[model samples]
Structure formats: structure tokens, C-alpha cells
Target: MEAETVSKKWEGKVSAGLPIPTTAAQVWPFLEDFCNLHKWLPSVDTCYQVDGISGQPGMIRYCAATITASSTSSGRDETMIKWAKEKLLTIDPIKRCLSYEVLDNNVGLKSYVATMIVLPIDGDGIHGCKIEWSFVSDPIEGWRLEDWVSFLEPSLQSMAKNIQDALLLL
Candidate 1:
């Protein structure tokens, strides 16, 4: 008899929702652009199309984010710019949903897949929606599930705020 080998990939899933004071219809346009994440994510410095077409699967985007770390030995704030290559997976305009997966990233999380959806909700006659951002990825080597959740919460909050602000400017 031949011996069989099994491999396991530890996965972590987390989501965060931000209530926006706008309708899903209004939010869909911004979310539709695969390489426009930098416009809404405050942490992202820039996002450019690397390959394929916008809004299409297999479209690769290079996204760079400016991150600030704790103070260094000299007491000056430390900042670093990191980038990632991500591929668009699927998008459903009618459903106001989009998804993408990370191909390579400077931060080192593996097999990261993320989805964002805009959902309509009754806001007492106010046109409002909830932006839900979720991701499934191989757990960070030394971090727990809660740590990932903490890392994501702020980014989602910033996106929600920026989206609402952008819509107001239009």
C-alpha cells in the first residue's frame, strides 16, 4: 500500500460593515473600478493597472500604501511604502458586489481573497446603505484572528468615510 500525504492551509475569515448615508446605486460606481481603490482607501497611496482590463477578471493591479510604523531609535516617526499585486476575481454590478485576490504583497499574507458589497438598508427615509468588506486568507504566521479583524476595521471605516465624502463632492 502507498502512503498518502495530506496538506492543510489554515484559513482566517473576517468582515466589517460601515453604514453609509447613501444608496447602493450611488456607491456601485466607485466600487466597480478594480484599480481605483486608492481613491477610497486612505492608506493606499496609489493604484495602477498592471495587466488586463478594468472590471475584468484576471486584471492585475499594483497598489502601494504608505504605512507609518512606531518611532525608531532616533525618535523620528518611521514610514514605509509597500505595494501589492492583486487580481480581480469577480464583479456583479447588479448586485453591487466585487471581489479580488492578492497575488503578491509586501506584507506577506498568503492566498488572500477579499470581497466588498454595498447593501441597501432602510434608514428612515434616508437613502443609505451598508458597505460590507470581508476577506479570507491564510492566517498571519504570528498573529491571531482578532488581530486581522483589528487591522481591517480601520481600513473599512476609512473607505466608508471617503466614499461618502466623495459622493458629497460630486
Candidate 2:
């Protein structure tokens, strides 16, 4: 007898973008390294290259983050550490874009994929780029698009600021 397989459908999608006051060239350097996320994204505790090659498709990355107890509304009093293994699916430096999909994570989401793209704006060197992030996931129960947006916005907004500041010092 043959067995049947079940597939989970995506439940929600969240998209957010932030304008960075820097050129695409400047921002690309900050985002190119898959293992360097921890340096710019405040929420990431660490990111390490696991397999294949950096910036190439099939490369794997292990990322860790700490979820403070106070940040959760579940009334827990202890902090938690979350981690995930993600595989690089695509990368295009010329267009300043990259995409990755999560392979495994301690988080509740069953499926997740994200893409980041940078585009030029109408300004010069210090103010001419916008970084946009789009995420699609099959969220677990009790989660909504707004919840995902709220979870991602702070880190992305912080990353934009970090990129702008780093470029200004150059």
C-alpha cells in the first residue's frame, strides 16, 4: 500500500520596508555576509556559516537569538534562547537581493522564507537607498500577520539605522 503525504499551507505574509540613508553600495557591504547578521541586527545573538560557501546558494547558516522574558506576554518569568538553521536559496549582489528559507527552528512557525532587497531612491550617496524585507510563513495557531510584523520591525528598523551610521563613518 502507498502512503499519503500532507502539506501545510501558508497562513500569513508580512512585508515591511525601511529607507536607509545610504547608497546601495554602502548597504550591500553590510548585508552581503550571511554570517554577519549579528553585527547589524540587534536581535541576533550570533550567526555562523554552517555549510557550503558564504553568499552562495545552498550555503547554510545557524542563527541564535535571545527572547527576553519581559518581551513575551505569556507571563513567563524566564528568558528563552531560540535558534534556527537556514539555507541560502538565492543571492544577487548586482541587484542587492537575497533569499533564504528556514530548514529548522525552535520557533513555532512550521514554514518560513524571507527575502531582502535594496533599491535606489532619489537622493545622493548618504541618502539614496531603501531596504525592503518580505516574509511568508505558515504560522502556528494564535499568531497573526500583525504579530509577525511587530516581531520583525524593530530589528529591521535597527538594521537600517546601523547601516546608515556605519556608512557615515566611512
Candidate 3:
């Protein structure tokens, strides 16, 4: 009997950038923490370290995200919950970038890897920064590549706004 091969190649890619009113120095602090995604990602209700140490490679984080959709037929809103366990693959403080892979997820994302980078914006007297997020994953059931990009762009924008608002409070 022949053994079946499992392919782990990423089939879809999506990326987006959001301009933040704060500098990279400030943004890096938020992203480098590794277990505080719920602070900025509006849809993520909870995120915590599941294993290893925070901000270090080999660490894993468990996140629970919720999405509410209005149902016209039912005259109510439906809430969906997604859970994912992601492992930290790499961290580069000098470049203000980190990479992570999804080890397990209930959302049907397979072989998922994502990278986030905080880029400093200089010149024109602009002191803010931009957050660049990119990811690759295997094809998800009932979702197209464009759908993933569209969904993420707004999420990144919201996250940037949340970061800015949090900084203002400080």
C-alpha cells in the first residue's frame, strides 16, 4: 500500500498596509507583545499565550474572534465565533517585523503564515508609521482570495485606528 502525501503549500496571498499616526517606536511596542492582538483587532474578543514565552520564537497564542452579521430574514443578528492557535515563527526587533504560522484553526485556514511589519514614515514632517500585514494560506472553503483581502483591509484599518486611540489615551 502507498502512503498518501499531504501538501502544505500556501495557495492564497493577501496583504495590506495601514497608516498610523504614531511612530514605529510606539507601534512596535504593541505588536511585539505577541499576545495582545485583542487590544487592536476589533473582531478578536480574547487572545492569550497558550505556550512558551511571549515575544519569543516557538511561542503559541490562542485567539477567539467573533463576527456578527445582521439577518434580514430572521430579524436578528447572528454571531459566529472562530478559534485559532498560532505559533510564532520569527521575530526581528531591528526591522520591526514578526512572522507567525497557524498551527491549528477552526476557520479552515491551512498552512497559514503571516508577517507584520512596522515601517517608519519619514520626510514631509510626517512622524507617523505604517503597519504592513501580509499572509499566505491554503484555499479556504467558500472564500475567495479577494474576499480575504477585502476582509483584512478593513480589519487592519480598524486596528490602526485602535492603536492611535490607545496612544492618545497615554
Q: Give the alpha-carbon lDDT of every model.
A: 0.79, 0.77, 0.83
Better of 2 and 3 by TM-score: 3
Candidate 2 wrongly placed segments (more than 4 Å): 1-21, 70-76, 123-127
Residue pairs in collision within model 3: none
Model 3: per-residue lDDT, tens digit, 26-46? Answer: 778888989999999898999
- The per-prediction CA RMSD against the true structure, in angstroms, equals 3.6, 4.5, 4.0
lDDT (C-alpha) at residue 51 in model 2: 96
**lDDT at 88, model 1:** 89
User: If both were scored by lDDT, which would come out higher, candidate 1 or candidate 2?
Assistant: 1
| Candidate 2 accuracy as TM-score | 0.81
TM-score quality measure for candidate 3: 0.82
**Local lDDT at 75 for model 3:** 100
Ranking by TM-score: 1, 3, 2
lDDT tens readout by residue for model 2, 68-135? 66636666677788999999999998888898899998887667888887777654545467777887
User: Clash number for model 1?
Assistant: 0
